[model samples]
Target: MIDTIIFDLGAVLIDWNPHYMYRTLFTDEQEMKDFLATVCTPDWNEEQDAGRPLREGTDILVAQYPQHEAYIRAFYDRWEEMLGEPFHDTVELFRRLKISGKYKIYALTNWSAETFPVALARYDFLSWFDGIVVSGVEKMRKPAPEFYQILLDRYHVDPQNALFIDDNYRNIVAAEKAGIKSIHFTSAGQLEKELEGLKLL
Candidate 1:
């Protein structure tokens, strides 16, 4: 039986669009794409999600792309806007799961400390979780075995009894390797089906 349900925040509960922020500053589509590619380079957001300070990451980006210094700053300046809105149906699903009292709900997200609180303020649904393990705050990120182990230890949950959901395939694979059953989240409908398949609902 699945005793716990771990959820990914962005792309799962909320609508996050990197293009929204880039579009605000860069009118040219190709230029905006390139800028996004540069800013979200593996080393950049990865480090930030893994607990690197926001200012430090921003400084690195600024140093790398001096031509867009102001724009780079604006990226973090308008960070909240990138989180478009909560998906009401998904929020409702979480609420239902919580109220069912069938499983312990938790949030495991790869988020920067600076951005997490801002998102929490806008989306009250986040408070529903029994535990929230944020990468930046925990200094560990998805796809890392240590991070999942941290959740396991903190919650005192058995890997076989846990179900982790994420939009990223690699994260799901990692969780599976750690002995936690996982689902690559695509949509609320798909998630519902997966839960049903496991007889969680």
Candidate 2:
């Protein structure tokens, strides 16, 4: 029986999208997309998620792409703008699960440690989790099995009894390899159905 639910914070619970912030920075949609694709790629952002300081990451990129210095600096300087309001449906589910007092709730997210404080301060619901494993603080990011293992080991959680939910397919595959069952999150409505099928809701 699944006694624990591990949540991926970014897409599953919070509305975090770099596009949201960049849209306002660039008047041309194509230009904004190209800038994100070429300059501040997901791979580059992942480094910060893997414990590289935002300043260091931005500095490295700024040095390499000196022409795009302002854009690079905006990444860290206005990081909070990348985040949006919480997904109320998901938050509702989370609160309901917590109220049940039957399952253990935990969070595992690939968020930059430097910018995480802003989220912590902004969202009161974040404190609801029994524990939260942040990749930036741990120096590892998911789809890394070691990242999942850290949560399992630290919490004394049995992978077989845990259900991991993430928006990324790669992370879900890694979780399954680590012995935890996982769901690829699409929407709160879908998640609600999955939990119902599992008899968790």
Candidate 3:
């Protein structure tokens, strides 16, 4: 039986658009793409999520591209704009699950401390979760095995009794390898079917 549900924040609960922030700040697409490729890559985000200081990351970016130092800072400052609204129906589904009292819901997200509060302020539904595990605060991230182990240990949940949902295939694969049941979320409809298959509802 699935007694707990772990959810990824980005692309699952809230939409993220790298292009949106780029378009908003830079008039030149090539420059924007180049900067993203070199400086704002996933590795940088991961480092930031793993408790690396934002100012240090910003300093590194500034040192790399001296000409766009201010622009880069502004990009980080307004990064929250890149995250769009929450997925429709998912919030309602979460509310339903919360009221059902059949499963414990927790958020396990690869999010930076710098950006998480912005997300929390933007989405009130975030407050509904029983527990929240953010990579920045935890100094760990998904697919690392330790991240899932921390959640399992903290909640006293058996890996077999937990279902982790994430938009990233790698995260789901990692959770599965850790002996936790997982759902690779593509859409609300698909997630609903997966839950039904598990007889969770």
Candidate 4:
């Protein structure tokens, strides 16, 4: 009886990876790993994802790790290089759902507010989403119960009739905690099968 579908943007649909860009910046593979782990860690990036200004985040990181200033600046300066575009098979399913006119399709993503516009401009299919709740825009990222509530409240989405798909297990857990059905997305084919099993495809 699900009438709404929520999709996580990164990993699930968009193949966004810092490694894609970092591969060019550092010649040493171990150094790249060390830099990502210690200098520009995921925790640091998540703060930006939670509505911190990109410029401010970049400057702070630069000051904290002065040795990595160039690399830190490159993270946002050449940000688009990280985008690998949308997964075609999953997008095909989304388009099918759209064409059927039977459900509300939405995007719930934890992306930086400043850099997200680049994606909107590059991906035409983004326009097809009935609604989008960006963590950066809301100043709250996923895995937080309040963030999910915002999506439910703002969109007036019926929790019982919604199906959430996210590549991150933490986000999936949060969605389930909010009383929405969820899928820990892996492949496009797997998602199609899940939708079929739900009789939503």
Candidate 5:
């Protein structure tokens, strides 16, 4: 039987996008897109999530893109602005799951260590997780079998009886390899349907 539920934080439970902060900085949408695509790209951001210091990451980008120094720095300077709001529907579903007393709820997220504390302080629902594994804190990230194993071993969770939810297909595939069932989350409504179908909701 499924006795554990794991949720990915960004995009699944929280709405976070660089556009939320970048749009106000650049008048030309294309310019912002180019900066995000070429400079502070997802891969670069993932480095921070993997435990590289934020300052170091920002400095490297600033040195490489001297012309866009301010923009590069602003990526983290106003990082909290990138956070939109919690997905209320998803949060409600999570709340229901939590109070159901039927499964252990946990979170696994690829977020910077420096900024994660801000999220912890801002969102009360975050405290509801029985446990959380943060990439930055752990210095490891998803799609890597070892990282998922850490969570499984640490929690003594049976991969066969646990379900993982994430917005990233790559992570979903990795979860399957770890022997954990997973949902490639797209929307809260779809998530609810899947859970209900599994007799979880």
Candidate 6:
């Protein structure tokens, strides 16, 4: 039986997309795509998500690609603009789970500690979680077993009794390997069915 629901913040609950912010920065869509692919790629952003200071990460890129310095700085300078409104379907599920008061609710996300404050300030529902394990705070990102262990050890949550929900296949695989049951999130409606099957909803 599942006693806890562990959630991933970004795609699962919050609607976050870098393209929304970048589209406004560049007049040409192709140029924006090129910048995202070559300059500010997901891999580059992951380094910051792994606990590297945003300033250091952005500065390095600014120095390396002097021509794109302004663009590089805009990544963090206009960081808040990248975030979208919460997914209402998921938020409703989260609220229902919280209101049920039968299970512990937690979150595990690969978000930078530096920028998390903004999220905290913006999202009132974030306080609903009993706990949240942030990769940037732990200096370890997912697909790494130690990160899952840290959550288990800290919360004393038995992996077998907890359900981890994430959009990333690799992270879901890692969570399963750590002995936790996981759901590869596609949409909130799909998640509802999964939870219903588990008798959690």
Model 1 steric clash pairs: none
* Model 1 weakest 10-residue run by lDDT: 37-46
| Cα distance off (Å), candidate 5, residue 153 | 1.2
Tens-place lDDT digits, model 6, residues 10-117: 999999898999999899999999999999999999999899999999999998899999999999999999999999999999999999998899999999999998
Greater-lDDT candidate between 4 and 5: 5
Q: Each candidate's root-mean-square deviation in Å?
A: 1.3, 0.8, 1.6, 0.9, 0.7, 0.8
lDDT of 5 by residue, 1-201 (tens): 999999999999999999999999999999889989999999999999999999999999989889999999999999999998999999999999999999999898998888999999989999999999999998988888988988898999999999999999999999999999999999999999999999999
Could you give candidate 3's per-residue lDDT for residues 34-72 as a string of tens digits?
888876777887888888878888888889889878777
lDDT against the true structure, each candidate: 0.86, 0.94, 0.85, 0.92, 0.95, 0.93
What's the TM-score of every candidate structure?
0.95, 0.98, 0.93, 0.97, 0.99, 0.98
Off by over 4 Å in 5: none
Ranking of candidates on TM-score, top first: 5, 2, 6, 4, 1, 3
Summarize candidate 1's per-residue lDDT along 123-169 as a digit string, tens digits: 88888999998999989898899998988899898999999989999
lDDT for each residue of candidate 2 in 124-195, tens digit (9 for 90 to 100): 999999999999999999999899999999999999999999999999999999989999999999999998
Considering every candidate listed, which one attains the maximal TM-score? 5
Candidate 1 deviant stretches above 4 angstroms = none
Q: How high a TM-score does candidate 2 get? A: 0.98
The better-scoring model by lDDT among 4 and 6 is 6
**Candidate 4 lDDT, 1-201, residue by residue in tens:** 889999999988788989999999999999999999998889999999999999999999999989889999999898899899689888899899999999999999999988899999998899999999999999999999999888899999999999999999999998999999999999999999999998898
